[model samples]
Target chain A: MMSFVVGIAGVAVFSVLARVMQSAARGTSPVAILAIAAILSHLASVALGIIYVPQFQYWSAASIFSFGVMSYVFVFGAVYKSVSLEVLLAVAGHPDRAVPLPYIVGHQVPEIFRGRIQILIESGLVEQIGSTFAATAAGERLAARIARLRRMFAIGDSGLYDFPD
Target chain B: MVGLVTPAMNFLPGPAQTAAICLGIALPLLLLCYARIPGIRGAGSRFRIGCATAAALFAIACAVLPGERRIDDVAGGILLLATAMLLVYVFWGLLAWGFTLTLLTTLAQAGRPLTEEQWAAAYTQGGDIGKFARNRLKLLLGSGMVAVTGDTIAATSSGMAIARLARLVRLATGLR
Candidate 1:
């Protein structure tokens, strides 16, 4: 239990470290950064525990560390490109710290749209050709797999937020 | 008399340990079952139900598993199991409600190139982007993250709190 707690502390430390290092390595994917940080953190934490503590459970420390890192990554992924979050941030950033709803729907949402398009194009999943855009083979394969999962999960492919009945 | 420490040292699990293992295994199966329930509509609600089901099962297992209890083991197992649920939900949510993902899926499903407008139409099931915008906005409003009065929209106190947390997450994750 002590080792496990130590591991979680390591995750906390390394996640913040990764955030600081992100600026220096601008091109690196956040997931990659987090993965590397998690491994390094676990290693450092467990190593210190082994050298310092006479009785440290390696597997227990590892199990808790793994879960903590995964949870952090999950949260990072959630807020990464959240449209609703973006809207809230915009309003929160306002000088008056308030804005009109139409301003968000009219301006911010479209901006988000364009940003998403840019991401797809840059990621090589989709390409803009003339006035039209098409998905690459990689994109199609991923889309197909997502489609399958959605079907298995009974989720609609539309991706539109459905109001709960 | 010879004292032997056989490998069969702890063949039987304590009650909490048994319960933890059962709940861990049952969590995924519960999600699969809930997926088939038509009454659970939105992706958010479906994920919530899965978590709720897992929690309830864990509680029941705690009650029913027969033996001495190891509280720490049970707690650790619950954390591990809950972590798995959160991870799966994150990926599943990405596939379900991710904006960029939907765009790519729509374009791929089209079988040909589509204009920006065409893709937006396809994304919203023939409705304009406004429909999608309203849907997302409804989430923000419904969650009490943001409120609108007349033409103006403002972040509520909770919204501001959430906004701070979001920024903190962004900074901590090197997103900003």
Candidate 2:
């Protein structure tokens, strides 16, 4: 119980630290900020546990801490820029909570598509040249590795949910 | 007084925690084995099977391991295994289905510069961006987050609630 309490306290510290860091540095990636904070808090929690809590099982503390942190990250990632959530939010924000399917199909989805392309470009993975896009050398290497893994695992590259055929 | 306050220190892991550590290590090895098996087709199914196998083995280990079962030990073991599963799933999901990663892979496979139209086509295997939109819409509709009425879509009541929750999460996570 002491370990679990300490683990949760670590998570709380991570949350507070992440928010502060994000507020202080606007341009930094949230995921990276969260990672740094999580590591720091986790180490602190373990150290404090060892110093204060008698019978503090290392694995017990680690397990609870990992679960808490991962769950936090999972929720963060899901709500970050999920397209389905974006669509839902868009419609829900509308005056009538509705939108034309064509508007979504034509305007919103393409905007999202372009937004992702911009992200890739910013990440230096893809390059833009005269209204066309191509992968950079680094991007090619990564893509090749991903392709190999997909082939090995028989995973489709479509990136679409594989509904029953 | 100090001695009365300080409890006994035992840093050793419980039996179930030991079992969890061993089974957690075995999960990725099991996934590698599953990759070689043609019977398991999709990444999702294969991963699910791997997790199920690890869980079954953990149960077996708990039952067979020579230690009196304690609730805390069993619970800790479960949490550990769950953490491992979540970690591996996130990594595997990124490699298998990450949108940005797929976009990169698609462009790299193209071997040349592609216009927006060509890129979208390649991304969807000859389909337009509409296909991608429909795919996402399918998820929203399937999950009852939205309802389609001929040409328009509306968020359901539950959808609005979820949207509100998502907004709260975004605010809390400092994504705004």
Who wins the TM-score comparison? 2
How well does candidate 1 score on lDDT at residue A137?
A: 87
Q: Model 2 fnat?
A: 0.77
lDDT of each model, Cα atoms only?
0.77, 0.87
First chain TM-score in every candidate? 0.88, 0.95
TM-score of each: 0.88, 0.94
What is the Cα-based lDDT of residue B152 in candidate 1? 88
Model 1, native contacts kept: 0.64
- Evaluate residue A122 in candidate 1 and report its C-alpha lDDT on the 0 to 100 scale: 94
Give DockQ for candidates 1 onward, in order: 0.47, 0.67
Misplaced by over 4 Å in model 1 are B1-26
List model 2 lDDT by residue over B102-160, tens digit each. Answer: 88999999999999999999999999999999998998999999999999999999999
True lDDT of residue B21, candidate 2: 81
B1-176 in candidate 1: lDDT tens per residue? 14422222122434554555566566666767888888887777877888887788777777776665565556666766666677677777787788889888888999999998898889998987777888888988999988888988888989899889989888777788
Top candidate when judged by lDDT against the true structure: 2
* Model 2: per-residue Cα lDDT over A47-155, one tens digit each: 7777778877777787788888888888887888688888899999999999999999999999999999999999899999999999999889999999998886677
| Model 2 DockQ (Cα-based) | 0.67
RMSD of each: 4.8, 2.1
